[model samples]
Target: MVSVLTKIFGLTNIEIAEDIVHDVLLKALESWKLKGVPENPSAWLMAAAKNKTLDFLRHKKQEEKYARQITPLLQSEYTIGHTLNNYFSENEIKDDQLRMMFVCCHDSINEESQIALILKTLCGFSVSEIAKAFLTNDSTINKRLYRAKEKLRELEIKFEIPVPSEIEKRIDQVLKALYLLFNEGYSSTEGESFIREELAAEALRLCLILSQHTAGNIPKTLALLALMYFHGARFNARIDDEGNILLLKEQNRKLWDNEMIQEGIILLNMASTGDLVSTYHIEAAIAYEHCIAKSYNDTNWKNLLNYYQVLITLTKSPVAELNSAIVISEIDGPDAALNVIFKIELADELKNYYLLPATKGDLYFRKSDMIKAKYFYDIAETLTSSPFEKKLLRKKSNMCT
Candidate 1:
C-alpha cells in the first residue's frame, strides 16, 4: 500500500496518503464491527484508500489538474474493486517492497531516519512501538520521523525505484534495515516481553519479499531469508505458557515447525549454490545444525564453535567474539572460554551491553562462583529493559541467594 500510494501521490505526499489510509482503517473497524468482514477484505481496503485519495484531490481542487493522469489510472478494471491479492502477487510485491525499502533506507538518510521511515511507511509501526524498539522516548521517535519526512520532502527526492546500475550499491543499506527489524523482534531490547512476533513476522515477510525480487534475490538475500526462517520456526516454542523465555537448549523439539525447517534447508542449499557465502549463510548453517539435533546433548557444539570462530573473522564484531566465547565454553570449558572472552578488547561497543554481563553471569554460574555470578546478573538486571529479562535475572539471583 505504501508503494502504490507513494507512486501515485509521490513521496512528498506520503503524510497525506498515510492520513487517508488511517481514516480508511478507522472506517473499516467501525464498518466491520457491524457489517462483518467483506468477502474480499483487501480489495475493500484498497478501494477505500483509492476513494479517500480521490476525495482528497477533489477537496483540494486538484482534480482538474490531475484529471488526465487520474482518470485513466482509476478506470483500469484492475484498479477498481479487483482482488487486492491480484495486485500484490508474491513477485510483484517483493519487487515493489524491496524498492520501497531501499528508498527508505537510502544512504542519504541517516540510520535514525532510515529506521523511522521503515517503521512508519513499511512495517505499520506506531510512534510508540518504534520508540520502544529503540529504547527512546516517543517524542524522540516522532521528531525523527517528522524530520525524516521533512528531509525527503525538502530534497524533493523521487519516489520511484533506483535504476539497475545503482541497486548494487544500495542493497547493503536495505539489508541492514531488514536485519534491524528482525533483531528488534527477536530480542526486543526494550519491552514488556522478550519477543514480538508481529514485528518478527513483518521482518520475515519483507525478507521473503526481497528473496522473490530479481534485483534483490541475491544469494545473500536467500541466506538471510533462510536464517530468519530457521530461527523463526522455533519462535513459539522459545517461550513457555507462563511467558518466560525457554532457552533454546530446553525448548521442546516436538513443537518445532518441521515445514519451516525444511523450507529453510532448501533456501540454504539454494544460497550455497549461488556465489554468496555471506556471514548470514554461515549463521543459518549453524542454526540449521542446531535444529536438526534431536536433543541438546546431541548438539554439534564443536561445529558451532568452528562456525563462530570463522564468524569472528568475517564480521570482526564484539558480539560475534562474545558468541564465539559462548560456543567455546560449550566445546572446550568455561575456563577456556573465560580466557577467550576476557581477552577481547570490546570496550567501545560492549561496556553497557547487558548481554556481556548476562553471558558472564552464566559462565560464572557454571563455575559455581555464585558471588561473581550474582554480581554480573545484577548488572544485567539493571541494564536490560524487558520485564521478562528482569524476571529471568531475578530468578537467577534467587538461585544464588
Candidate 2:
C-alpha cells in the first residue's frame, strides 16, 4: 500500500504516502471494531485507499504538488480517475513494490539506513521492532530512518527499477540487506528467542518477489533465495519445546520440511545456470549438503570442508575459517581443529564473538580436557546475551564437571 501510494505521491512526498496509509489503517481498526472486518478485507483496504487517494487529489489538485511526473494528468478531472485506477491495478502494485525496493536501496543512503528503510517501508516493521531486531534503541532507529527519508527527498529518487545495464550493481545492495535481515532471524544476536521467524519469513517473501521480477531474476538472487529456503526448512527442528537451543546434531531430522528443501534444490539448480559463482551459491551448496544428509553422522563432511575452503578463499572471512576448522575436527581430529583455530591470523577479530570460544569449548570437550572445556564454556556464556545460547553453554559447562 505504501509503495503504490509512493508511486502516486512521488518519492519526495514519501512521508505523505506513509501518513495516508497510517490514517487508512487507523480508520480500518476503528471501523472494524464497530462493524466487524469486511468479507474481503484486502479488497476493502484497497478500495478505502483508492477512495482516500481520490479525496486527497480532489482537494489538492489545484496545488499541483504531488507526483510531478504525472501532475498534469492528476489535475485533469477525466485523467485523474483513470490514472489512479491504472496505478492501483494488481500488476502496477507489484511493479511499484519492486521499484520501491530499489528506491529504498539507493546508494545515496548508507547501508544501515537502507536496511531500516526496507524493513519499515517494504516489510511493515515498526520502528520499535526494527530496534529490537538490531539490539538498539528506538531513538537510534528513528534517526536512521529520518536521515534516510531526508536523503531520498533531497535526491528526488524515482520510484522505478534501474535499467538492465545498471540493475546488476543495484541488485547486490538489495541482496546484501536481505541476507542480513535473514541472518538476524536465523541466529538472533540479542533477543529472548533464538529465532525471529517473522523476520526470516519476511526476508524470504521479499526475495521471492525479487526472483519473479525480470531485473532481479539472476543467479545470485536465486542462490540467496535457495539459501534462505534451506535454512527455513530447518526452523522447526532448531529448538525444543522449552526453547533451549538445539545443535544441528541434536535436531530431529523428521521435523525438517522436505517440501521447502526440494524447493531450495530446484532454485539452487536454477541458480547454477550462470557462469558466476557468488558467495550465496557456495553457501547454498553447503546448506544443500546438510539437507540431503540422512543423519548428522552421515553428513558428507568432506564436501562441506571443500565448500568452506572455497568460501574462505573467496571471502576471507574469519567466521568461515572457524566453521571450516569445525569440519576439520569431524574429518581429522579435535587436535587438528584446535590447531587450526589457534593459528587463525584474524583470531583476535573474533575476541568478543561467543561462537569462537564456544567452538573451542566443544573441541576441548571432545579431547576430554574438562577444565579447559569448562573455562571456554564459561567465557562463551558471558559473551552471548541470548538466554537460549547462555543456557546451552551452561549445559556444556555442566558436562565438564
Q: What is the TM-score of each candidate against the true structure?
A: 0.89, 0.96
Per residue, candidate 1 scores C-alpha lDDT tens digits across 62-176 of: 4554444344444445553333343445454555566678778877788877877887888767788877767788999888888888878787776655778987778778877
Q: Write the per-residue lDDT of candidate 2 for residues 129-164, one digit (tens) a residue.
A: 888888889999999999999998898787889999
lDDT (C-alpha, whole model) for all candidates: 0.78, 0.89
Clashes of each: 0, 0
Model 1 residue 339 CA deviation in Å: 0.4
Every model's Cα RMSD, please?
3.3, 1.7
Flag regions of model 2 displaced more than 4 Å: 67-70, 192-195, 345-348
Local error of candidate 2 at 163, Å? 1.2
